[model samples]
Target chain A: MSKLNDWVEASPERERIYAQEKLIVDTAEEIWEAMDKLEVSKAQLAASLGKSKAFVSQILTGSRNMTLRTLADIASSLGKKVCVRLLDAHESNAWQSVDAVLISRRVAGFAEVEVSNDPRWSNVIPLHKESCKAA
Target chain B: MAYSLRIAHAVENISRNLLVNLYINSSQPMDEYHSGSSLTIWLWEGAEASWAEAEVGVMEAHQAQFRARLARLAEFGRLRVPDHMNSEGDGIHAVKGNTGLRAYGWFDRVSGRRAFIISHVVLKKKQKLDPADLAKASARKDSYRLSKESK
Candidate 1:
């Protein structure tokens, strides 16, 4: 195990703190991404929410505790929606790997269908295209 | 040369060598995810010592947040949030938090693999980062580079 893993696993308190901080950082990062995508500056966001620029800065910098209402408000201001997901410990770490596998499978299926429809593969798998069409 | 000046130079050399040694010995990949694309995050010994000196709960929380940010940088190849992480020019970047904790480092190709090597950590008391702190971090970075090139 890495030193970080060992440190986190050494105590339940440490793990709890780590999990909590991770969520906060993740949520803050999502909001930042949304703001960037929408070209919304912190000052603009603060103005739209009728709050001070410092308040918006505090929320983005993880200085203030953000409530669900605050998150909803920010999302509404940015014309975005809030999404919350709860994953088990195992799934939390491996979600990307699982998603990558699922994505690769979907892409392979599409490639197979495309290949089957190609004239080069018509003689090799004459019935494959018909089966794909029916599916 | 004056005795005091000679002694000062010797002490400086010793400290620089010690820092370089610490940089070499403390290099480790942060295990935040199982992805193969993760970049190695090297925590300098000084940074670890400073982090260790923090209050237990605060230390754990900051370390967690820092690790998460590094993981995101590793996975995504860049962190879009300038508030969380930003380049400090000349290839040096800072991973900062609202709690006034900042870890300064630079990216370099280590052993032919890209890595973000943390040179030092500082807890800022002022609203603006003291130029001295950045200079110290930059010095450490230069020392690390010189040592690497010599090897």
Candidate 2:
């Protein structure tokens, strides 16, 4: 086993902590990206949320614990909505690849397709154009 | 004077051998097609030892935070946030954690694969990196280049 694997398996607590940290970092990145797209500054976000600029800075830096309520508030302040999904361990990294495949299939005129067996492309079903038109 | 010169050469050889043996910590498949830009991460054995030391000294939460940041870098090729990583000029960059843990390294392209080879690790005590640390990392990068050229 590699040293990284050993470090990962050293303690279950480490994994749990890592999960929390990843969520915080990912959420912070998302907020930062949204702010950049919306042309919102830290001071502006703070004004929208009626909070202090330092609080927003803390959120961006992942130095403060961001609860679901805070996340929703931040998203609303930025004129965006929060999306939360619980994905399986395998799907977490593979979902993007599956999405890309579905998009390519649509572009290639394969309106309807089913992907299975392959874990990377698993659990994705592309909707047919007829079905979309009917809807 | 000749004997002293020989002793200096022997010491250099021992240090060179030690530097040549690196303890890598990457989980990416080198040849796999990744949807995201994937870069392999490499750490010198001494740097790894320093990381282990930092892991032992910090809180478990901080250690996990550091690992997760590294995992993101390996998975995504780059950290999206500048706060997490940014170039320090002169080809040296740093991977930073919220708790002030940092790994100083540079990017390399080897065999058509991009890699981030960590030359050193530090638990930074200041908001800005010390110039001495940057110089050491830069010197190590030069040594790495020389070693590769000799090969």
Candidate 3:
């Protein structure tokens, strides 16, 4: 009956829930990557874990907040273990030190060559700059 | 006489460095208006997942929605978020999914182009963003800017 132009904005509570959802998604991805490395499939993983393919699919898509028991079961089946750490302020400093060196290296490397050679190309190219003026 | 030659050589070195910096600064602006140059996404060392990898880490339906939102961000030069989602004028933008997914990052201009650098990904269980997460993102933005300047 009603048509909305943009997606509905999230409430504070919804934001929190989405945050949890993101965690499940990230965990699911890790599990998927492990399966890939181990050369396993959802069907294979399901059989090994004595679970159903549908359940595995749900887990991978973050349809539910998986219990630690389920996660441990999945990890153990895949020859892995779950390690959780709550970092202290000093310890968590390591997370913030997301070394941008790699990114900068890529940019600077390109700049060294491109900027040095052409002396005209921008260090980074803005998308939609030519078409849109506001940005 | 020998000292004079050495002094002249030192002046030449300083001048050469200055010229290089000037040349880089002058040339970057002209290329800004060119079409077809795509935006760049940089992940941190420990955040070692390709954008595709990160995309696959969510629900099947949400993945498409996430991508569509990203497309809008690229088109608009900034990702859209509810006004309440912003972190107090810190330039950080966030997108919240109806399902459980939130992406947070800040925008930085590189050579007149905007680069959206993600500070952290959160899985919330509470009603408010952890102040620490905001700090982490802000720190990352600062580090990125500092690195850019040093270059």
Candidate 4:
């Protein structure tokens, strides 16, 4: 951990920050897979991201939240694009539609973690507003 | 039973500076038997709070005191608190190789009992608390010697 303690530290740009955020939440396994497939190293990630190795350590160790754009740049470096979509509320459907949604979080060519990407939802969710309120 | 400590603030600081995407959040209570992915230990978190109950950071020396107390609880068959509070990954042992990190805390699903609830964005070992881990217990020996008056 750097001797720092706050997020007020100087940052390059918002676009970069957003990109970094997307990467931070990525699964370590996913990142490892992407890097392994592309033949990249932590040093290369830092060099491409224009950050220090120490900073890269923070990002990889879940110590940082890279912005969406920064994550996109990192992905782009790897030849990937972050993708997203929205699911609206349908009156006829059992589930209520959401007003707005933040669809895809892309990392250029590296990898993507999306709602549709994962297929591990096995539990049934009852569509009851009261239950929602209780939860 | 179990407790969840927030180390996100600390994690955020490190990531913003270093620029990495590793993050860990507790989706299920620590008591929930860890399956392939029960405890949410992700590398990033754009905005989803699925597994992350909160954030996590490295523990300070004093905070290590809390870990020791929590450990004593477990030693007496009470609750075992986790050693590395907000560390990412399964038991510290897995993270540290063989001379691995000591994975503390106990989990009991029979009644949904969790020791320490922890979530971490960064997974670095900050301080070595093991060196002085049991030092305090040994120091009090002189004072805890049956308390001459009580004997």
Model 3 chain A lowest lDDT segment of ten: A92-101
B145, model 3: CA deviation in Å?
1.8
| Structural similarity to truth (TM-score) of each candidate | 0.65, 0.69, 0.36, 0.31
Candidate that beats the other on lDDT, 1 or 2, i.e. the better one = 2
Residue A48 Cα positional deviation in candidate 3, in Å, after optimal superposition: 56
lDDT of 3 by residue, B1-151 (tens): 7556655766776587457536644643211211111343334433323333444556545644443344334433433233113453477666444353455677665544455555555554466766776677677677766666776
Which segments of candidate 4 are over 4 A away from where they belong? A1-23, A27-29, A85-135, B1-32, B36-92, B95-151
Q: Write the per-residue lDDT of candidate 2 for residues B1-78, one digit (tens) a residue.
A: 755665576677656533533221132112211122255577754677676665566887877677667766665566
The numbered model that scores best in TM-score is: 2
lDDT of each: 0.63, 0.65, 0.48, 0.31
- Between 2 and 4, whose DockQ is larger? 2
Which prediction has the highest lDDT against the true structure?
2
In candidate 2, list every pair of residues with a backbone clash: none
Error of 1 at B99 (Å): 2.4
- How close to the true structure is residue A43 of candidate 4, measured as C-alpha lDDT? 85
Q: What is the lDDT of residue A47 in candidate 1?
A: 97
Residue B122, candidate 3: Cα error in Å is 2.3
Could you give candidate 3's per-residue lDDT for residues A21-113 as a string of tens digits? 434644664576567668888899999889898898777755556899999999889887765645442121111101212222222112211
Writing each residue's lDDT as its tens digit, candidate 1 over B18-44 gives 575456565532211212233556675
- Docking verdict class for candidate 2: incorrect
lDDT, candidate 2, at B55 = 59
Please give the distance, in angstroms, between residue A64's alpha carbon in candidate 3 and its true position after superposition: 20
